[model samples]
Target: MRRIAVPWGVLALWVAVLALAGPFAGKLGDVQHNRAVDYLPASADSTQVAKIQDRLPGGETTELVLVYHREGGLSSADRAAAAEQVADIDRKLSLVRTPEGVPSRSGDTVMYPVASTGPGQDEKARDAFVNDVRDLAHDTGAGLSVDVGGPGALATDASEVYQSLDGPLLYTTVAVVALLLILIYRSPFLWLVPLAVAGVADFLSMGVAYGLNQAFGTTISGQSQGVMTILVFGAGTDYALLIVARYREELRRFERPYDAMRAALRGCGPAVLASSATVAAGLLCLLAADLNSSRGMGPLGAVGVLCALVAMLTLLPAVLVLLGRRVFWPLVPAFGSRPKERRSLFTAMGSSAGRRPLTVLGVGAVLLGALALGAFALPGSLKQEDSFTDRPDSVVAMRTLAAAYPEASSQPITVIAPTGKATEAVATARDTDGVTDVTRGRSGSGWTEINVVAKAAPQTAAETATIEALRDGLDGRGAYVGGPSAEQLDLKDTNARDRLVVVPIVLAAVLLILVVLLRSLVAPLLLLAAVVAVWGAALGIGGLVFGPLFGFEGTDPGLGLLSFVFLVALGVDYGIFLMHRMREEVLGGAPTGAAALTALRTTGAVIASAGLVLAATFAVLTSMPLVQLVELGFVIAVGVLLDTFLVRTYLVTSASYALGRKVWWPGPLSRRLPGAPAAPPAEEPALTRTP
Candidate 1:
């Protein structure tokens, strides 16, 4: 009666949940803000100027540059073709200002700086306009190459890439998890239960994330949403793996399925709880971030993990109990039937570490340190145009314009000033260092807009200096200088500041949580230090490969901070599982060395599977079209692998063995009783504990 009622109740609850989640989950993609200014730090001058521009007369112009070129030089026919196309664009699109062609010095290229307010402030409408222009330019041009490049085109291209990612990312992630589960379980029927539950968790997360946006005005970006999906499949599957493995073990001890699941949950529940709590607490730390995208990702990601935890802990258990041992089918764990006792890979690894714990620990440390040095080889900060892994039309256009218009501004610097100070601001901008030209446009409410062009190319170091000079020059006149170049500059600076402020906070927060859970100062610090080393080594590996092998131009500014947060948060998860087992064995009266080896032997395979699932999920990002996503995926994936095979398996086990009971310093386990039986030697198996 109990099993029957519980399974039916759990199934019914999930049915109701899916029904409610379907609608909101479908709508989550609709609220994503992928525009350049949308991702900028809130207090940035670029953000302020963009807001002021949005409230102006036309509500921000959709500006573009249409470049026409012939390799040798423009002929009579080329010039005629260029004019006819420009005229068609003006007539069909109804430009806000009719652009006159500006010819290059070599007569090989002509550029038209076209502006239109037909889209107003709607991102979708603006995308449509940019797409239309690109289509016409590509479809109509004859014997001349036409490319549309500017902020508007770049934003549209980026949105298109982001929009396309949802389907492929989901499919690829699901396939990867399914394949891994099939191999690990070696049962044709067993893998689907956990996979299906993970899918439910992912859908639930999407709905909750959408709710977060509507209620709290959380900034939902494509990047954040993509990450949430990965966490659901990755972390959810991890929890499912641990529970199912424990349930199988308990099945051998208990006669009834319900009784077996009860004992299993009681055994593994605290470890799973502590693991998820560490991950959520670390993600919640993202709230202190300055960038809207990074800050918003924290709450949304935490929601994913907690939602997954609920589904795995409640729904998966109920369903598995109802299915009974038959779900294991070809390899069922019957009542009193135990797994074959034999030598395994993890057992062999434990044996090796036992022989020379210090030697094993020292060699592993040196290898990780060597990997850490590769970070110095990484490329510089990634440019906006180089952010995408594939070359979109916008990127191609920008590259072409860069070559065609060297030492000439391809993009303008935007300045917003008080309408009363407009004239004086324009005069100051004109006389400022590095300013080649300035033009005033669009006055409304109490502010005015000015477009200034520097002699240096867009986003070049010289142009960056020019932007700073203008902002400093007009600081007292109620002016804000902003544009693509300024936004990139702000992004770089704010990421540095955010890392300085947030890294320590994340470390301290995760450290506190570990200390609380483990009830030991030395153990938590050791775990934190181990994860930090993994992060460095992983980053260094990325530095060595990202440029020469992957062809990425530069690293994303926020990559370091984000990678640190995730590695420390998620890496500590496996540490918690092992340490919890160790603690359990120790408190149950197992000697220190025996307990450490037993814990390693019992939990090693599960940690390896969980690590593979997690690393594979993040590795899915390496196949994404954005370089930043790819880089993040590579670093995190590599870091997880290192933590699994090297840090968790060997270094941690070695450190535990070498320290004896001292590893749990200040904890009750660290002190031995005066009259207890003599402890077994390190060579003996810890018969007192078993999986």
Candidate 2:
């Protein structure tokens, strides 16, 4: 009666919590922002420029370029039509000035540069203006085509892709997890339990995330929210797997469902808690990053992992206990019924690895090292046009402009100077090397805005040099030089600096967590070393594939750092699970060799399943239109797979086997008991237990 009442009480409590969580969760999407300014560090020159622009009259301008092109030379009619459209746009939209058409040297292409400040800082208004322009700038259909582009249009397109990510990414991730669970459990009702709980966890995380944003003004982005959802599902499902596996095993030994659950929690709760703590701790290290996106992701990711942990440990267990052994359906484990004994796949692999630990260790290390060499082949920082996997109108426009205006920049390098020093700043900017032209516009709020054009195109090294020169020349002159090109330059430099700071913090945090959990210095080091190797190898694989196979023009600036944080943190989870079980076996009187093999034999399948689920969740990001998400997803997913199969199964296991008791060095287990034999006793028959 008490057991039944407890389960009912928990269900009622969850219902109340969900009722509260439901509203806030729906509001999370409302607070999400994907603007380029949102991702930049507040201290960056580009961010300061954006902020100041918002304060000036008419607000930040939305710049656009209307590309009018024909395969052959543009006829007089085409030019006239282009002019008429530009005139209509100027009349209909609130333009900074009437746009003038610039014809290409080939006489086949013409571009009309447009700018409007009517939208101010309102994203909806800005998007509406872009859409209105796109509608008004219709193609001639007879040969002449039009593409509305530039930084503003590119931002709109990126926002749309980000907006689309929420629905499809969630559904795809859910479907993938459901399918995998169906296959892994082979039970009709079993998969639904964990999936439902994960959904609830996701709902809860969203609510918490929204509250954090509102209360603390934490920056929220599409990437961070999407990743939060993934963590809620991926990490949530992993905790579920470990819990359910232990619960299933306990059900066979205990008479009542409540007792069985209690035993199961005692068995696996430490590992699950430690796993979530490690992930949360490691993700929290991202707070040290100077990049706004990375910094925001830290809290959001930690929130996700912590929420998943709570749900899996509490709601999942209560629901499962209430359902009792019958939840497993046809394959339900009856009380006192032993699982089938057979030589499983993990048994064979473990035996082989244990037989030649050094050989297996050396070979696996070499394979990972060889893969790491491919990192050298990775492309440079991704340019704006190449950021999208699908070529939208904005990308097309940029490409067309690049081909047509081979030597000139269509984008402006914006410099904001003190109103008092505007004259001096203008003269200095005009005199700066690579400066093709300079125009002074908009003066208010103690600042004057200046637009400078470069001889080189946007994001090119020459343009980068010009931006640097502007910053250097303007140093202490109370002027800020920034624009799309300057923003990219700042982003690249900031990401590089962030890697140096965040990597060491993440490593120390994760290593400390591992040491505390394993109670052995050597064991934690081995696990950390294995996961780091996996990160490098996974990135190497991306290098080999991203450019040649995927046709990606460049890598995302944040890829290496983000991937390392995820891989090292998430990758170490499997190690903890395996090592935890090995420790358990050793404490249960099994010798070191027997324990390593035994842990692998018992837990490998579930670890592999968890790995598959996590990898697949991230793999869904590959299906996204954004190249950054795709690159990040591909690297992390590959790293998880490598960690699960190769590093955890082969290297860590073999290293432990070879090290014997020394794997537990600095712990009591490092020394043999008084009566223990030098050599371990024969191994016991392996059980084919799986969850």
* Model 1, runs deviating above 4 Å: 139-142, 673-691
Q: After superposition, which runs of candidate 2 have C-alpha atoms over 4 Å from their true positions?
A: 677-691
Q: Each candidate: what lDDT?
A: 0.88, 0.90
What tens-digit string does per-residue lDDT give for candidate 2 at 1-691? 9888887888899899999989999999888888888888989999999999988899999999999999978999999999998998888876787557989998989999889989887777888999999999999768899999899999899888898899999999999999999999999999999999999999999999999999988889999999999999999999898888888888888989998887788777878888889999999999999999999999999999999999998899999989988889989998999888776789899999999999999999999999999999999999988999989999999999999998899999999999999999999999999999998989999999999999998899999999999999999998998888889888899999999999999989898888887889999999999999999999999999999999999999999999999999998878888888888778767778888999898889989999999999999999999999999999999999999999988899899999999999999789877356444422321222474
* TM-score versus the correct structure, for each prediction: 0.97, 0.97
Question: How do the residues 440-522 of candidate 1 rate in per-residue lDDT, one tens digit apiece?
Answer: 99999899999999999888889989999999899878899998889888888888988998899999999899988888878
Candidate 1, run of 10 with poorest lDDT? 681-690
* Model 1 collision count: 0
